[model samples]
Target: MTETAPATATPGTPTDPGTGSIAGPSVAYQNWIDRQSRNRRQVQVGRALILIAFLALWEVAPRAGLVNPMLTSYPSAVWEGFLELLAQGNLGLHIGVTLLEVMISFAVAMILGTVVAICLWLSPMLEKILDPFLVVGNALPKIALVPIFYIWLGPQGSIYAVAIAVALFITILMLYTGFSQTDPNKIKLARTLGAGKRQILTKVVLPGNVHTFMATLKANVGLSLVGVIVGEFQASKAGLGYLIVYGSQIFRMDMVMAAIVILSLMSVAIYLAVQKAETWLIR
Candidate 1:
């Protein structure tokens, strides 16, 4: 009868004493996870500290007469202006109006642009015919057309028109490019399997371009907001943009700062929402 030797741990390979099971890799993995967690917490702390330092400097600079308070209101004054607006009960209304306009423009641009991109992709002749016109239109300074939109569509309609104009062209261009770039080998395989163009598009192309769609959505958020603000600057009676122009005209720098702060926060929230949606889609 032959005797069996007991399994032993080697260098870099720890073993459970009783069962002789390998445990080193699991411990190393746990250590890596801990390090990653620490790194993320440190990054978050660093960001908070930087923001605090900036706010402190801003608050101190004007008080010390390093800069004119009238021209550059501090954080406290902006907060006060925000409170005053809230008390006036119009702050909510302005925010709501701006948000509604942004959402409408975003939805319209995304839907219309995606359909246009698909149609262009489906017909190479149509794409070729429209290519030069699309390029020219996209290159045209959209800001130059603001007054024309206002004249043609009036105040509310002009807001939507301007917002869509800002976002639609880029969306179509990006989606068409992404669709055209779908792996040729995959398309060839689909065709060889007797798939029609529509099936190839729905099964292979659309699913593959989800990340592109998310990218377009993110870009459209900022562009649509910019267009709405620019339109409101010219044609709006009420909105954050209107408030900004009104405040500047009245030389109420604090009020202007407050509106700008709100706009920044709003944009951040919308961008974060889009990021979260992307994460969900990828999962």
Candidate 2:
């Protein structure tokens, strides 16, 4: 029998079925990628369909005389109003003022709320003593306080008042719950490792409750905007809320709708930013 040439296999060398080259990606991985692409496309299609349907109805109802265009402006009118505002630069000024108020109030509320939460967390007695006060404060309608804030802090006083009203209860309840629910085993472990109360709180409690804090922050963003707008409604010469009041008083529904759209966009942006920050912090 003729001796067959011995098949030689190189050591530490991967062999391919045909070209002897390593594969790029597995079939499973490619399938997963395809699935993700498909899902994203589906989502895009759904959003486009919804937007088209809404615009179609918005345009048709008014044009068909089913709805009075003078009283309720269509999407095109709102778009035109937005373009006019952009040309005049007044829109930018209003947006800036509203943003400033929201940011300042939110910052103050965050700092004060965090400090109070920490204090309450550190002392069970203080939390218990303050619980009733917190309950009552949260229960009270914050809008009713706009006038009081205007009187106390002047017309602009609503900024601080609204921030406090919106954020106080959220921060307190979230942080208190987080503190109370601290993992006992982790606390014990830290103590065993010679960690002091301060160390435990700074290292363990704070980190552990980060998710809760983020959740509270997300909720407070909308609340903060509401407070600012409501405050503006009560007393303000500038801001989107002022724009709405001005537009309504003049029967410029287009302007009112435009301001509303701006408010909605701003709120969404703030919320999305908070979410991104939370994700980054957690990661």
Best by lDDT: 1
- Could you give candidate 2's per-residue lDDT for residues 19-67 as a string of tens digits? 9675455566667667778879999999999989998998899989999
In candidate 1, what are the lDDT values of residues 1-283, reduced to their tens digit?
4333333345657677989876554555566667778879999999999999999999999999999998999999999999999999999999999999999999999999999999998999999999998888778878888899999999989999999999999999999999999999999999999999999999999999999999999999999999899999989999999999999999888899999999989989999999999999999
Regions more than 4 Å wrong, model 1 = 1-25
Candidate 1, position 195, lDDT: 98
User: Whole-model lDDT, candidate 1?
Assistant: 0.92
Output the worst ten-in-a-row residue range by lDDT, candidate 2.
1-10
Q: Which ten residues in a row have the lowest lDDT in candidate 1?
A: 1-10
Give the number of the best model, judged by TM-score.
1
Clash pairs, candidate 2, are none
